[model samples]
Target: MTTKPAIIILSASVLAMASRVASDLGGEVHGFGKRVPDGADVTFDDVAAHLAGLFQERRPMVAVMAAGAVIRLLAPHLGDKLREPPVVALAEDGSAVVPLLGGHHGANVMARRIAGVVNGFAAITTAGDIRFGVALDQPPEGWALANPGSAKEVMADLVAGASARIEGNAPWLAGSSLSLAEDGEIDLITSDAADAAPGRGLLYRPKRLVLGIGCERGCETGEVLALARESLSEAGLSPQAVGLVASIDVKADEAALHHVARYFDCPVRFFDAARLEAETPRLRNPSDIVFAEVGCHGVAEGAALASVGASGELVAAKRKSGRATCAISRAQQPFTESNLPGRSRGRLFVVGIGPGSDGWRSPEVTQMVSRATDLVGYSLYLDLLGPLANGKTRHDFDLGKEEARVRHAMELAGEGRSVALVCSGDAGIYAMATLVFELLDKADGPDGLRDGARRIEIAVSPGISALQAAAARAGAPLGHDFCTISLSDLLTPWEDIKRRVSAAGEGDFVIAFYNPVSKKRRTQLAWARDKLLEHRPVSCPVILAANLGREGETIRVVPLGELDVDDVDMLTVVVVGSSNSSTVKTGDGRTWVYTPRGYARKEGTAMTNTIPGDAA
Candidate 1:
């Protein structure tokens, strides 16, 4: 069904005529002047060479030949390598442009484009023919065909000389719209009736959806959006393709959710939290707090899936503000098995291998690795898991090249293999799990990865992240409300990083910074410290853990004012404690770090009840 454009010339005379027509039609022409005029004995070799030249230059070309004869001559050469050309046969009198090949591959469209220049008519085939309309299958870049069958029907109507009615949510398509003749024998209709005449087409459907979601607490909205996209991708849908956004009632006031809704340029409809809870499919390992507060699984994935009903399915889920937010869209069409992984079902595990150490690696993660058919990760990560990846197919790339690694893993898993994409810490924490869903959301179409019948399961097994381990090793600096930030500007911009640091400092929150500094990126950490100093005291405790849980590891604490930016590198994690965090020196001259229990009064009261001297 894939179409390509090409040009076929039946004879020397026809080739010469086509060259003249191409020039008049505003297309670059080749291959007619070198041969004898009126020569009908043209070989397939000559035709193919000219066609190949056009394709090599990435331009659309048409072949001039009789339909039946051209198919016979080119059938043997019609393998994938032929690079389809727009085939237009002359009818002795050049009245029409016929697109025999690549009807959708730009041949038919190109013919029309050229026909306008040559003052000729293009013979297009498809339904929903309107004087001016865009093909459903051929949406603009960044937009996807939500319904291809409908698109084909519309195009077929157009080719049958019928006109169409066009409607859209926005006026973006007006300028680039195609044209049909005023008297093209087509009618426009607004009704969705099936009995509408050949020329009648309806552009608007009120049932088309737009979903907006919000969450409680501090759940990251970006993560939720990623999950929602995954679900939509699984159903072969797009955010832009939906008419409205359906989200939880609680998120109606969330700034982040509003930001996303604005970006999508859609209306947000909030549903009752109870309704969302009632509709959410029960998961065995639901986060308790999420279920209790949101009356459902609070992940955007669950909410979006529920809001869309069975039609939209689940695309994303994330916990925010003690509640979960999700966005849902109605499924456009039924997906096929070919759209999913080739096998019956497949599993994608986002495993956090744990701060580059086997000892800290969870047993569940080890088992998952051992059971996997393929292992995908950075080369260093793959090397770290070499012992566990003995029999598995390894797909190793470079550090910071996570997108490619995740893509390769998805491709393998799409083929029905049990694949695991590796990450350094908790898979859910700044790891492959989120990226996997993001990629799924942004997939172009339902091409062998949208089948709902095939199981596309993903799970994240928690492993100790550097921040957690570093905090534990350096005492209880993380015993209170805290947050983790990455100083690496690879994904997030520096402005965002600075803003987050400033926010955390103002909130008096402990901050764990990953990717603190590298050879090329030295100033960010210094900038971050200066921002933090705005809200924190000079003597605030800052713990630095370098090569944590690895050979040549170092864990030390320094005052915020004394922190040396030069000492940090990619492998270092910096933990900046709140102003209240302090250091205690033991009699043995070893320094330990601790944050006040905040329950000191209660502890003192307990001591008084037990022993009098202990109270002092």
Candidate 2:
């Protein structure tokens, strides 16, 4: 079941109260403007527009304000009651709580829950809910409604003293509070796809089936989708009951098989040939030819039984189309992550979190961190993430242990765990990504690494580097040409650093210096400044930015001659301009720095601008 996140909106006056409610309710908080609550994850400008968008997206919302404000903003989007998301309104001081929409679709339940959080009263007005203590249309978790249109009539009959019949083997039917009689006019049937018997009845579908699929290369995806749907319909199975799709690892990239999985809205699992061949003794119709070709007796049936584990049984034998095959299995136990070892492929994500701010962090980095089973980074860098790193296994290392950190992350991934190796700036920019690839190259059979480390899948997610951050702070300093040089000789020799700095000066490139000067290495920045002075004049602009996108940030533009060697530190990025770069003061009395692209020279002679040899 997918639990949609709830959004709590409040004005600045009641931000503290709303923050308390939102925290207790376990959802995201959104404030109107400045002076937002301290715990708000996001802030917005226009309340009406944001609320309407939330309504359209069908996300549950709790508005801590007058009920009229919510209703007026949501009136234009008020269409379907059954499909609409839950909407609740509460008083600022926790007095009254009301369900404004989606009463049957969890609004009433959410209202009561929020009321409990606020120590107030829930105003539930639905008649069936007050009488029967359950919503007829909305089934319990892991249950789907076959036809939602019949819920209203059945609820009406039940509320009007009409007896109901429970005509299925579902255990939930025994605990239902509805008036169930041996023979009654209204029927409630629990089935995979049981049809109506000339009367009003609600069909509740349970998730209990797993579909296994195998397809040839270049097979049409539409054919597999249609055949799978037809087989489910013929077997009296609801598409909603599909738990997963299983296949062999060799067919992991088969398009048709994945398409069928998507149509059923189920996860796809693949088993290696060794695991599949282990199940040959249990095959109903084992083929020697198939075993010889793919090392498996059967792909569909073997994958099905393997995915459902030891207690499951094959309900449908393997059925074939022109270029595809599928089978269905029923599990004795509930489907869960424990039954998902058939698809445990190792993956390692090397990511950069950018500077230490929520605003500067990319969405991809957050998602990678949240999905990772292990996080490996410097101790200080890990501490910057705060609550986002909660509940994950942290492998913190001191600085200068980059090789050990990347190796540990890869070892975890080799054990079939998802690992994220975090860096501060961009991962590819003097970060751990290169070290990961280097370790993989050397892990061939030596260097005391696990044999599986070479096979773990790896990906690099880029982030905003410190040079880009510094350039953005000082407007357009890198507009023409630029090159970055790290002054640290810990990795590279000092002779090479001096050569690169000298080359950058001769080339007249806008130089962005990273790792400018550390505690022990104080002479490199001064040497580079003297070297650059040989090409550009003393009055050239130089922008010094330190701690970009983080606390204690500062940006100062100074003349090249006044470039303070004492002020430069390891955390500072110095961007020195070229000969064409200049500064101008705007109407707001702020200095802006930019390098001209030589278009001004042409603009000054625009009237006489002509191509050479254009005369007759």
Candidate 3:
């Protein structure tokens, strides 16, 4: 199942440690302080209020603070232990982990899971867990208890050494520590319902039922809900055993169907008509009306049978109300998100993670990376994702394998997996986004290597490009009309790059040069500098910012005449000023570079302590 992410709340003092802790647990980290670390996925101003909100929403949380502080902040909102989300408190030093609330709902289990990561002690105080090493009330994963209020008395009897008899077939009962007998006073019936006497063992319901629903447009939510309950009741099926609600994709936005799913608190799945129609031979009620209207033989019955796969049997056929129809099917195994029908036809996320700094990375990029099942990028770019890439299948390539990387991402996405193609700076600017489109456009070539590339869903999320970072570092060199040009002749001819540089220089546009120089290509930056000197004065301000927003970063403004090729490298972005660009010295003795944007011509908007006037 696609479980909700845990909320890891951290104080300012332990922001870094908490970020690592959240990444290790694959949870979202929320920081509370004046200046929390950038590693925190969320930041909050009020700790007490936010904690209360999380509690009200029933979101599982791990507060990285003293247990006493967590208790003080959360005590007011605590109610209904059975319905509450797990709240675990950890020491700032990671020495102790305590399950403060919802031990059965998963706080104790979460604490022990985190203890394995942080190498700390899980202070579990539950009596059943301490003695039996299992929660009798909380059924195993994927199993739901029909009536949990009945668990207390049965657990008490078991604790008092009462013998019990297993009445139904279940794999879990075989290995359980329950005192079993052929005929006992306490009967542990594991069937769909409890058929034994009133005061008996628990009714642990396996999630084996799949409810398929179809509704007319604008159907009432109440009618859909009523029909669903009636169908299950008529089939002698327990409503608690329903695991999935499936329908045709055409009904994905149907409010009535979704309302029924919300009532059950189960995921609503949508299958395409093609997938639903494939089960026509197995469908008990193949409707010509449904086939003509929705291009499917059956929606309700077909969706249910499709969800449970070939081994499943339809227990309840289609039952209709005034506006909706419902069906139920039983599966040999419980339905999970992974095995659900109508899987999405892959998505390719072209993400740009900024210049290797955690703080500079965009939140959208982080979210995309977290959701991606496959991460395809260069080795260094993948490393920049750090702990976020822990569970994702990493397809790391060397620096020169751009085509291979793009192809791998597209193929994985074609296979219906969420894939992220990572780029260093902005994916759209001198990055992978353009290459992805180019490959898509050229897929019908002689080699036919990129067939079906156009069908996959693609998205490009912008990031802080190297030129933007350089301009920001140099104090707004890109304030006016400017253009970016890469000097590398790897793809484009050197003669073409030289012409573009000359044209940009002649037009007096502030130019940012990318891929300026390398070990073999040493003189491109110098050659471009000489061309810019023709249009701008020898004393024009030129900002050479290397490794901007990353380690060992440096930003310096030099005269056009004093531009040095030896100091420039492929990693540096050289932002050359226009002829009208001016530099002003700040009080701290650092130079600020900016170009005029004609604000001087307007009234009462003159630039002060900075460069002013239009180039004209």
Clashing pairs in 2: none
Summarize candidate 2's per-residue lDDT along 28-106 as a digit string, tens digits: 5666655563455555566888787667767778888788989998998888676798898888878988998888878
Error of model 2, residue 493, in angstroms = 7.2
Clashing pairs in 3: none
Give the lDDT of residue 153 in candidate 2.
83
RMSD of 1: 24.7
Ranking by lDDT: 3, 2, 1
The reply for model 3, stretches above 4 Å from the true place, is 1-64, 68-85, 92-96, 100-105, 112-207, 211-242, 245-311, 316-328, 337-345, 440-459, 489-508, 518-531, 586-589, 596-616
Residue 453 CA error for candidate 1 (Å)?
12
| Minimal lDDT window, size 10, model 3 | 600-609
Measured against the true structure, the TM-scores of the candidates, in listed sequence, are: 0.42, 0.77, 0.64
Q: What TM-score quantifies how close candidate 3 is to the native fold?
A: 0.64
Q: In lDDT terms, which candidate is top?
A: 3
> Of the candidates numbered 2 and 3, which has the greater TM-score value?
2
Please list the C-alpha lDDT of all candidates, in the order they appear.
Answer: 0.59, 0.77, 0.79
